[model samples]
Target: MTLNVANCQRCGKVYLKNMYGMCGNCIKEIDLQYDKCLKYLREFRSCSITELSEATGVSHQLITKFIREGRISIKGNPNMTYDCEVCGTAIRENTMCEPCRSKLAKETNQMHEDENRKKLREAQENHNTFKIQDRLKDRF
Candidate 1:
């Protein structure tokens, strides 16, 4: 197995890095916090993100991360609002709001279309350019 080593963001300890950018100890701590938050939610049911974080001592960012991961949902409970990554607009399900997602999709499509057009133009130019020597028969 390949070892990817890095420093833990929470404890500042040197260790093999994982996807969360934190070491195992910190990850466990976060898991415990997630459990705490979940328990609190089950009891409070209607608590807002602020209240949840305040009660559980978990950071707002972590709770948002959990929401983004689809572990926690705010469907009917309007109190829990996941914000848009770009504009911080309250979103329900996804990481981004609908408007932001649409805008991003359009921009991405436009960039790809522009790139393809440039390539096609270059290809046409290369194929259309003719040298006078080509019109004449070879000496052989």
Candidate 2:
């Protein structure tokens, strides 16, 4: 087996024979993301998967796992909401991160606006066609 030797990212300590390439302290730092997620949830009373993902930079899948395994929950409600950990913005049903929440909102809004504009353009084009047909009919 090739023994892993690497320097700890947090403390800059060089560890020999480390299999994960990170020292114990660095591993703890990695674990801290979960703590951050928990703390964020606690302070906000609830958080969506997207919000947690945004705040902790953790993947939504991992946050979903935490929720599924009963590692997290809302204070009073069995059904939890996802919100921004920093800004407390409500997130999507499955997303826990705030940034993702805002992004989703913006995208949704843009899609709606684009759809409306397309409809209006199509209506105007149809109206113009009808007007042209009327003018041609008059000539005949």
Point to the candidate with the largest lDDT.
1
Error of 2 at 103 (Å): 34
Tens-place lDDT digits, model 2, residues 1-140 = 87557677557797874565678877676578778888777766555566667887977766655665566655453336554554655543443475666777899999999999999999888874456678889999
Worst 10 residues of 1 by lDDT: 131-140
**Tens digits of lDDT, candidate 1, 1-140:** 96689999989998887798998999999899999988998888889999999999999999998887877777746688867898999777767888899999999999999999999999988897667787675643
Worst 10-residue stretch by lDDT in candidate 2?
Answer: 74-83
Residue 127 displacement in candidate 1 (angstroms): 3.0
Error of 1 at 124 (Å): 3.0
Which residue pairs show backbone clashes in model 1?
none
Per-model tally of clashing residue pairs: 0, 14
Which residue runs does candidate 2 get wrong by more than 4 Å? 1-30, 74-140
Task: Give residue 18's lDDT in candidate 1 (0 to 100).
Answer: 76
Top-TM-score candidate index: 1
RMSD of 1: 4.4
